[model samples]
Target: MIQVHAWADLDYDVLVRDMRAVAFDLDNTLASSKQPMSAAMTDRFAELTHRTTVAVITGGRYELVVSQVLDAIGGRADRSRMHLMPTGGSRYYRWHVDDDGCGRWKCVYAHDLSETDRRAAAASVETRARELGLWETRVWGERIEDRGSQLTFSALGQQAPETAKRSWDPDDKKKRMLVAAVSRDLPHLKVRSGGYTSIDISLPGMDKSFAVHELARVLGVEVGGIVFVGDRMNPGGNDYPAAEAGAYAVRVGSPDDTLRFLERLLVRL
Candidate 1:
C-alpha cells in the first residue's frame, strides 16, 4: 500500500531525520509542467542542497530538464550534489568537474531502446491512438515524443495550456483507454501514465525504481536513506515504483505544496 501525507499534517522531524538525500519529480512536483521553476523554489532548492544530496527523476527528456528546470533554478545549487535522471530514469546524468574546474553533465548510464524497438513502440502508439479515437480529439501541440529511452503520448499535445490539460483528463479516462490499447498492442514495452497529460512507454525494467537503485549504487548510499517526493504515488501513478523501491516517500498535491513541504523540511534540518 502507498503511504500518503498531507503537507500541513506532516511531521517534519520524523521525515527529515534519516533522509540523506531527496528525490523529486520534475513537472508538477518541482514546477508547472513545461514551465520555468519559480524564484522561491530556486532559493529553497539551493538551501536543501546544502543539507542533503538532491536528485530529479522525470519522464521528460534531458533537453527539457535543462531548458525548463535547471535554467529556472538559475544554476544556484551545487552541481556536485545534484543528479538528473530523465526518461523515467532510463538515462542517468551527473556533474563532473573538467580540467578548468567548470562543471559539466555526463551521462553515467542509459538504457536506450534499440532502433527496432523504438520504431515498433512508436507504431503501436500511433495505431492505438487511432483505434481509441484519440486522434480525433482536439490537441494543442505534438502528441508523441521519442525521448531516446522512452516514448510519450500526450493527449492534448505537449504544449497544451495547463487548464486544458487538467480539464481534459481529470479522471484519466481518456488516457487510461489509450494505455490499455497501447499495452495490449505492445506488450513488450512498459506503458505508464506520466503527469496529467501523457503516457510513457519504455523498455522493460526501466522505471523510477531502476533509477533509484542506480542512484544508490552511484552515490554509495542505501535506498532506505533516501526520500522521494512526488504528486503521483497512487497505484497506477508513475511515482508508485519509487515508493516500492523502499525510499521513504512523501506525496504532495502541487508545486506550491512541494514548496511548503520543503520549507518545513528545511526548518527541521
Candidate 2:
C-alpha cells in the first residue's frame, strides 16, 4: 500500500521560502469544466510566475492539452512559465510562442511504444479485461488506454454522459477494485488510477510521481523545491505519486480551490 500524507498540513512556508518552481495538473487542477479562469486567478498565477517557475503537468493528450488549454493561458508575462506533461507520464511538451502570434509545441520527451510490442500488449490487456467482465476500452489518440500503459475500461465508456461518469463512481470504488484484482495476477506490472474511471498500469515503477521528479530535474531543483497541486492523492489516485515524493502538495476541490491555494501562495511570494 502507498503511504498517504496530507501535504498541505506540512510547514508550507519553508517550501515557499526555498522552492524555485511550481507545477500543476491540468483539468480539475487548473481549468474549470465550463468556465475560464477568472481575472483574479489569472492575475494571481501571473504574480506566482514572477516569484517562481510554473508548469502544468497533466494526463491529457499533448495536442489537445496544449492547443485547447495551455494555449488559452498564454497571455501571461512568461510563456515559458508553462508546460504540459500528458499521456500518463509518458510525454512532456513545452510551450513556446512564435513571432506571428502563433504557438509552438516542442516535444521534450515521450516513451517510444514499439508497435510490435504495443500491439501484443494491447491484445493481452483487452482480452484480460473482457474475460474479467469489464467492458470495451477507450482510446487515447492512437493508443488503447489500458490504464496508462495499456487499455482503459471506463464503467461507462468514453461516450458515457459526463453527469453519469462524474457520479458513476465518485470515490473511484470501481477503479480501485479493478486495480486490486489485476495486481493480484500481474504483480510485475504497476496498476494505479487513471483520470477518474480507469486503471493506469505502467511498466513496474512508473507513475505520475516519476513525471514530477523529472520536471524537477529539468529545472535543476530538488524535489523539495517543487510544489504539486492536484485533487486526488489517496492511494491509486493520479496525484498520489507527487504527494508521495515530498513535493508540497495542495489538494483542491473545485478549480477555485486551486486558485484560492494559489492566492495564498502569491501572498507568501
Candidate 3:
C-alpha cells in the first residue's frame, strides 16, 4: 500500500518556505472530478498565487482549466505568477497582461500530435475498449475529446456525474487494463489512466513529469524546489509522474483537504 501522511507529518514550515513553486493536479485535487472548483478553494488558490509561483498541471484540456479554475478565481489572482500546464503537461499556457491590465492567457508551448497520430490513437483506444468489453452504451458527453496536445477517453463521457464516475472504477482496475491495452497498440505514445474513468494518450515525453521538469527549468528551481500536490500519486496514477520527476509530493483526499493544505501553506509562505 502507498504510505499516507498527514499534514503534520512533515516540517511543513521549512518545506513551504524553501519551495519556489507549488504544482497541483487539477481534477480531484482541486475540485470534484470534472466539477467546478468551489468558491472556498478558489479563494485559497487566488491567495496562493500572490505568495508563490503556482502551476496547475493536469490531464484536462486548457479550456476546462479555464472554466473550472481560472474563471472561478477570476480577477482575484496574480495571473503572472500562475502557470497552466494542461493535457497532462503536453501543453503549457501562461498569463499575459495587456496595457489596460486586462490579462489573457498565452500559449508557451504545445506538443500536439499530428493528424495521423491523433486518428490512430483515438482508433486504438476505442477499438481496445470495445474489445475489452469496457465501452459504455450510455455516456454523459463526448467520450473521446481531441485535446490539441493529447486525446482523452472518458469512459462514462465527459459530463458524467461525479457520483457515477467515482463509483465506476474506484480502484482504477478498469482504467489500468485499458491503459495497458492501448499502450501496447500505440507503443510510441504515452497512455495512462486519468480522472475517474478516463484515459489520456500523448507524446512519449509529454506528461506531468515533463510539466515538473519544464516548470523547474523555466522557474530556475531545482526539481526538489517544487512541490506537487494531487489526489492520485500511486504507481500508475496520472499524478505519479510528478512524484517520479522528483517534486515533493503531497496527497489530498478531496478539495477540502486541498483547502486546508493551502491554508497551512499560506501561513508559511
Candidate 4:
C-alpha cells in the first residue's frame, strides 16, 4: 500500500535519493487552476527537471496545458525529462525531436472515448444535473467540455474566475453529490471529482493509476520508485489512484505548499 505523508514528515534527503521520477497534478498543485504558472514555480520546475525526471498529470485538456503551463515555463528546461499526461491520464503527450531536429510534443497514446460512449456520458451528466437542480444554476462559462478522453462537468463553468470557483464549492459538498449522481446514472464511465468545481468522467481504468503505470514503463522504473505530489490525494480525489498504484505520495494543500515541497526536494536532489 502507498503511504501518504505531509511534506514536513518526509525525510527530504532519503526521499530524493530513492525516487526515479516525480509526477505532479497540474491544476492546484503545479499552478492555480486556469491560471498561468508563477515565475518562482517556473524557475523551480526548470531546476527540478535538471536533476531528475518530471511529469505532470492533470484533468485539464492538453491545449490548456500548452497555454497555461508550457508557455509559462518558456522552454529552458530539458523536454526529454518532461512528460505531460492531460485528461486525467487518459491521454499522454511526449516530447519528440523531428527529423529537422526541432522538438515538439507528440501524442504517445490516448484512450479516447467512442462517439457512442461520449454521447451517453454527456447525456447522463446533463440529466443528472437537471435532476439535482444544478442545471438551473448560473455558470460563468462553458459548463460541459469534452476533452476527447474525458467528459468534464464544471459546476461554476470551466472559465469561471478562481475566486468564484473556490467560493462555489469550498467544502466539495455540491461536487460530491454531483459525482455520486453521475456515477449512478453512468455506471460504465468512471466519474471522479476534480479540482474544486469539476467532475471528470472517463473510460473505465483510465484514471491516474493508468498514467502512473505508463510513466513507469516510459521511465524504466518500478512503480515504487516514483513519487507523486498533489493537492488531492485523499479518498475520492483524482490523485488518489497514484497512491493506490504504489507511488510514494505527498499530499499538499495548495500551490504554495507544493512549491515549498518542491523547494525542499530540490535541495536534496
* lDDT (Cα, tens digit) per residue for candidate 2, span 156-219: 5544544655665688776666677766656666666676655665565566688778888888
User: Candidate 4 — what's its lDDT?
Assistant: 0.87
Each prediction's TM-score versus the true structure: 0.95, 0.77, 0.95, 0.95
Can you write out model 3's per-residue Cα lDDT over 1-269, one digit (the tens) per residue? 23334544667878876788989889888988767899899989999999989999999999889888987998899989999999988888999878997778999899999899999999998999999888999899999999978999999999998889889999999998999999999999988888889999889888888999999999988988888899887777788878888888888877888888888888877
How far out, in Å, is residue 225 in model 3? 0.9
Task: Point out the worst 10-residue segment of candidate 2 by lDDT.
Answer: 139-148
Candidate 2's C-alpha runs over 4 A off are: 1-12, 33-43, 96-103, 136-153, 159-162, 180-189
Better of 2 and 3 by TM-score: 3
Top model number, lDDT: 3
Off by over 4 Å in 4: none
Ten-residue region with minimum lDDT total, candidate 1? 1-10
lDDT of each: 0.85, 0.64, 0.88, 0.87
- For model 3, the superposed segments whose C-alpha errors exceed 4 Å read 1-8, 99-102
> Which portions of model 1 miss their true places by more than 4 Å?
none
